[model samples]
Target: MRDAEISSWRQWVTGLMVAGLVIGTAGGPLVGQETDDAEEGPQQVIIERTPVQLRDPKTYSVSLSLEPIREIDLVAVADGVTGAVQVQLGGAASRQAEAVRLDSAERQLELERAKALFRVAQAEQRATSGGDANAVEAAEGRLEAARAELRLAEHRLDATVVRFPFDGKVMGVHVVPGQFVRAGQPLVTLADTSKMRVAIPVDRTAVNEGDTVDIKIETDTVQAKVETIVPLKAEFEPLRELFVSVATAVLVLENGDGKLKAGQTVFADMIPRQPVMEVPTSTLANMEEGGRKVQVIRDGFVRDIPVKLLGQVGEEHVFVSGRFSAADELVLSSSEVLLDGARAVPAGAEIPTEEDEGAGPAGRRRGSRF
Candidate 1:
């Protein structure tokens, strides 16, 4: 009986061992199946994207003060009493037009006297043509003296009238009729308003001389060209040392309509010198290391592209530079964390077409999942 029991116990132990082996083999496949399920699919994120291109340089609106291209105070050339003021304040004057005239009765009489003396000297020189050599030389000298006196008298008479140097508007009249005025005294203030100038402080790298740009004055928009760029004075050396890009640029604009005025405020559009890309301001993300970044879709996966934040274009858009292609699909926004190489899709139900992507910023449509 003991032998039979011992034999049965051994058989029972053998069966238990076989059952354990079977259970272990089945569990091994289950664990591998769990791992396969976990690794089967990539995380999906909802994203909005737009196609990017090397767009035109970004424009910045800078405030500027309009001033006349030329301004001058017409001064009296000769000392005299005011005879007449031909131009009124705010009146237009043509080039070389008489703007003021000083009293010249005495000068006119002097000119007539000099002319009579010159004529008498001419007659005397002719009468002495065949006379003694000493007498003829004396007559010739008298004729030359009288001629020079006549010229001087004519010049004095001409100096009595103040003429407009150019086509301009009389901004001020400092002399009145019958008012005693002295030489080198201001008689009129004239300004040429046919063209306007604006001296604006700008970034040295952004603007250059002779570049055409747009300017906005109230509701009117006009084109202007950069005339010159002046560096900051030595007193601003500290500013320059701190900010090397500071500079002053002078812009010239046509104002034939006289819409722009001196001391009037206007706006100038300044363009960046470097090529840049346009993206929504919300698309920029800060990097853990430093600087900023934007995401792009490549090969159905999300990838982070390092970008330099140039500046904002407007309220909604910003300009950035990066090693990117015109064909790149810039991810506008993402609902989930976009890890490098992670699979992504559009947030909406339908994927955008190539033509839709080219439709510009307004045509970009957001989808449900990416």
Candidate 2:
């Protein structure tokens, strides 16, 4: 019975071993299938980034104009050409003395006698050699004095008519024809507005002495050449405290229409082009760190690049300089999801810095917010 039992145990043990080998062989396909599924796992989708070239918006402002104003200078003496006043202007110095007269006709006769005596002295010197050189010199001196007196009389007679000094307009007429005016009296004041000038404030860096600017007066566009760029004085009211100052620039422009009057406020915009690095307004972003910045996409990761902004252009943004290239991808819109190392989709399936035109990339589409 022991022998039989041993033989049966050996047969059953052999049968169990065979069954285990078949079962292990059958499980190989399931293990291979599980390995394949793990290798091909679900993929994550990301947004896209792109680079573009657009016109730069860097603005340099200068004032339209600061003009020179002229007031009238009145003629002080108007002796002749009185009354029948046609409201004219002349140089004050050219006018004869007003209310000036020779004191007496007897005084004139005394002058005449002095002249006769001088002539007699001349003849006496010729006739007798009484060391008359002194007498002759004295006579000549006396004759000159008489002639001066006559000239004074003549000036008094001619002082009645007034003449114009230069081309100017008369502001007012004080007296009519036959109006007797005294010396040092007021005739009419005159003003000169023939040559008009303007003063405009500008950035010291934007303009130099010879820079030309396009100026517009209402509808008229004119080219105004810079005559001077002078440092504004400390006496200026508003600019007194500002250390970075507004400079005075003188420009010569056409005022033919005379539309631009003195003291009239002018609104103007200036576009000056200097060499500066520029990026599209959309390329820049506001940072949480309290300053402006840009998104720098590199190696399929996002980077926040710091930037310094200068000003703006027509519906565009402005910056002085930056390290980014035109081919670098930037995020246009705001997103809390964007950060350093964030995964991004590109415009094209071919992942490169630059995107080819008119093709759909991995995640970029027209409907998606930029």
Candidate 3:
């Protein structure tokens, strides 16, 4: 019985194989032809493209604090008690204006005595004009000594008043009326606010002196010019490690209206020094080895073009430089995998409107057949 069962199973399998061969001979060619047709047909990808545009270099923003163009601490030149305070804290001090006056009664008396002694010396020198040569020489020496003493007295008297060296704002006052202050002690802190200074960190290759930039403070925006550039020191080695050519840019902004103040937060927009090409940020792709690339339609086929990313213009756009030209059409979006040299059809070739450009990543999607 087992032999019979095995023999029957063999016969059934042989019959099924013969039947399958017959069907394949009649219908398999149709299925194979359909697959061959599909393989030979041109791939249909719903790709979105835009013409590459030449745009101004991207602007990089950096936060900074405003500082006075010039600041100094006015110190006491002589030991004296503050007799009067002419300028109050936060008040404007004019050039050559007296800011403080020390008690000068003693200084006044010393000045008077020096004047009297000078007059006496002059009279004695005149008297000795016809005397012996030795007596005349001694009188002349005495007159010279008196003149020197008078000049010293005058200088000491002048030291009693603290005068503003330049037009500025008094930021601090350390001495009040009747307060005794020693020589070299700080009396007032003054800052020249007619122009504001700010130090901005940026890529040295992208920024240069004399370049004008926009600075934002609170809600207001003002223009500032790059005054100088300073290389980073060893202390900024970490920053240098991150950005090899990192440096500080000194910028100056006019504040004649006194609207800008020191220590206020400011945002400086640093524009790139070189011109660059602009494209949508979503179009950038990463290579397996390294670096970035963008797809462009060339000869009706997808071509990969390597680009150097200079900076970002906005959330959706980027500045780049490479071998591509403004006439090239950049692949903004594609529904299928874009392989190098793969034939593709751009379904939307018209330039995207501003509203469409801002429609987020979803707007890049479209129905496609591959």
Candidate 4:
């Protein structure tokens, strides 16, 4: 019975195979036509390539705006003083102040005469045995009045000539030559150009004190130091006028040649000296249990590298600093099923060089690895 069963099963399998062959032969033309149609159809996939940028460690820089280290508005201290404008409209404040030395010689002489008269009155009183106290009192009153008049005269002299308080440039002169300026009236607007500074937003977390900054003003290159980090307060209240949403910091730069002027817009670069690695954000895989990671091709094998996202260049790329090699071929685009440690074949024409990476602003992207 077991032998019969085996023979019967073999016969059934042979019959099925024969029937399949017959049907396949009968539909041979139809199968060939279907294959031809498939070949003519739009089945070819066109995959565009984006090179993986193997960015080495480099100095990171931040954009900044140039401003004067110090600015002031000169005003009249005393009333009805003729404005001579000792400084030219666009001249240095330090040089202009030197020319406006106030004449206090007459006031000094008046003060000396008052002292002599007061001494004579005291001598007379002593000779008369403290009698005629009225004379002594009168003389004291006169002396006090003379002193007051001398002070007034000094103030008047100061008011007559506009003195430059610092080394700066005259931005504007509200008073004309021979113009009578009233008390508290604005005389001139001055700004110290010997050094320049910028108020950066407080959100710049990378910026710290002692960082060297580079800037360009027309044809001149200016180098400056991060003198201090000024916080929001009464003194820096003016910062609110420019950046109201975020807190700000003051970055100072030396402009000894006076190449930089207040109100002139210039670009400043705060390049850090530390070593860092920058990678494209698109190459990053996803946030897993471990951390943010990116897929790189090494020795024709896939690798998932952990990366610390530092910042974004723009919308398409990110600035990442991590343990990465400059020669690493990053997988910019890959299939959805490509897994870490799996084999991969790069489809890009060439990897991005350092020069190509510097062409545009950096950016970022978000997605999971395929």
Q: Highest lDDT, which number?
A: 3
Tell me how far the alpha carbon of residue 222 in candidate 1 is from the true structure, in angstroms, after superposition.
3.7
What is the C-alpha local distance difference test score of candidate 2? 0.47
TM of each candidate vs. truth: 0.55, 0.39, 0.58, 0.47
Report each candidate's C-alpha RMSD, comma-separated, in the order given: 20.7, 24.4, 17.7, 18.5
lDDT of 3 by residue, 246-360 (tens): 7777889999999898989875333233335667688899977799988876544457887777555546666666666557667766555666644433333432332754644
Winner by TM-score:
3
Residue-pair clash count for candidate 3: 0
Q: In candidate 2, what residue range of length 10 has the lowest lDDT sum?
A: 21-30
How does each model score on lDDT? Answer: 0.69, 0.47, 0.70, 0.52
TM-score of 4: 0.47
Higher-TM-score candidate of 3 and 4: 3
Cα lDDT tens digits, model 1, 1-370, are 1459647744754543333210001112211124455543233344555556675433332345787899999998878999889999988899999999999998999999999999999999999999999999999999999999999999999989889989998888998899998899999999999998977556688778999877677677778889999985443333232233767778898887777787787753332333467677788889888988888875444568777765455566666777676667777655455555443443333433446557554223222122
TM-score, predicted candidate 3 vs. hidden true structure: 0.58
CA deviation > 4 Å runs, candidate 1 = 1-64, 216-221, 233-242, 267-370
User: What would the per-residue lDDT of candidate 2 be over residues 6-64, giving only the tens digit for each residue?
Assistant: 47744754553333210001112211124455443212233334453323333233344
Residues forming the 10-long window of minimal summed lDDT in candidate 4: 21-30
